[model samples]
Target: GAALRTLTEATTPALARRVAALVQEAVRLRPETAGQVAGCVDRRLEQGPTARPVLLPLVTGLLDGGPEQVRAALATVLAAAGTPASRPLRRELLESLLDRERDPAVLDAVLHAAAAQGDADMDRSGGGDMGRSGAGDPVEAPYRREDEIRGLVHRTGLLLVRTPEGATLLDRGLADLGRHVPGFAARMARWLTEAPDDWAGMVGPGARRTIENLAGVRVPA
Candidate 1:
């Protein structure tokens, strides 16, 4: 009984983490853990979004585990995490899944995850849903600010993008200007460090830059 008690004490934490891990990882094994995984997911959902981030790694792990119902589970988990604030983590999940998952339907969902964030490829997002076409008539010679932000974001990073407004606030140009100006990334980083009480305006620096570079003006020299 002593040995058994020791084992239980030692394993309790590890087993708990494992149970959590297996919920997503079990998808890789496929079929074998199907029922158990479903139960785990149900329990996780019962706990709600508070636990969604913890589920990220497992869903990502199963993306490589081969053809299985895990895709359904992953889709459910991701859809749950699809709030505006979760966009960054969601983008990472999509890219990682793209590199792993071979199933076409699964891949399609991955693409939508990537595409839903317009600034992901360009500075864009209408509530994290892909809206209509680029915000300008392509026929114009001089591109508009939104067009520019879109172009710069595409050039900078394709994983996260955001829409920028006004001529004075160009992110890509600002990044470039900062390169010449120095302490820019540092200062900007510091300003953001203040952590405004409002997260509705909160966006990671990279995503913000994607939008910032896409600002609506010819960047000044």
Candidate 2:
């Protein structure tokens, strides 16, 4: 812990700036529970769209690192944004990572992000992104909240239902070119090469068949 002390500080205006962006991955150096993980990713999502560029780079690293890391990272992102940004961001982030992503783990997260959104929208199993309110509020994690859960779930769920304006960007953003991730062209090949039907296989048995049907994979029967 002593070693991480200096690194975690992120003090000073200069260090604080990139510190938020830079320290994201260090937390992923190991496994963290969904809540702990959420705080890590949400900090950036709580930032601004300007942070999108930085967030994308962090995704690239997580994607390149390993499957588990990528999954947790994506989960943190979804839990943090929940409805405020999860739905549309899901499509955009997936399109971004998938377009340039080659690693099965990374690609899986992109697809899984869609799945998380699907699960959250339907309020399945009474699980979804936890409350956006500060953690430790007792009513956090959506599941624990009895009074407001239904309303919160409905509002957040609606966003995921919409196709969003940018879902099709992958088809047209021909210029997004995923130059950020490693093995760019080959990664694009891996994603494009696969049948969209396969994506359904990645996230099967959810709220809407849209995910199962439109995704580049086949959903379980």
Candidate 1: worst-modelled 10 consecutive residues by lDDT: 159-168
**Candidate 2 lDDT, 1-221, residue by residue in tens:** 33333443323434443443444554555444323433444554555465465555544444444346535456436522254433345335544544444433333333333323333533532444544445444324433332132222222223222343222322222122223222222322333335334323222233223332344343334
lDDT of 1 at 64: 52
What would the per-residue lDDT of candidate 1 be over residues 1-221, giving only the tens digit for each residue?
A: 23322322233332544444444443454545543453344344444455455545444445555345656445434433233345445445544654555444443333333223223333233223344446452321212422432332232222222333311223334355334433333333333334333212324454345333434222111
Model 2, stretches more than 4 Å misplaced?
A: 1-38, 47-72, 75-81, 85-93, 124-221
For model 2, the local distance difference test gives 0.38
Tally clashes: model 2: 10
Estimate every model's Cα lDDT from 0 to 1. 0.39, 0.38
TM-score of 1: 0.32
Name the best candidate (by lDDT). 1
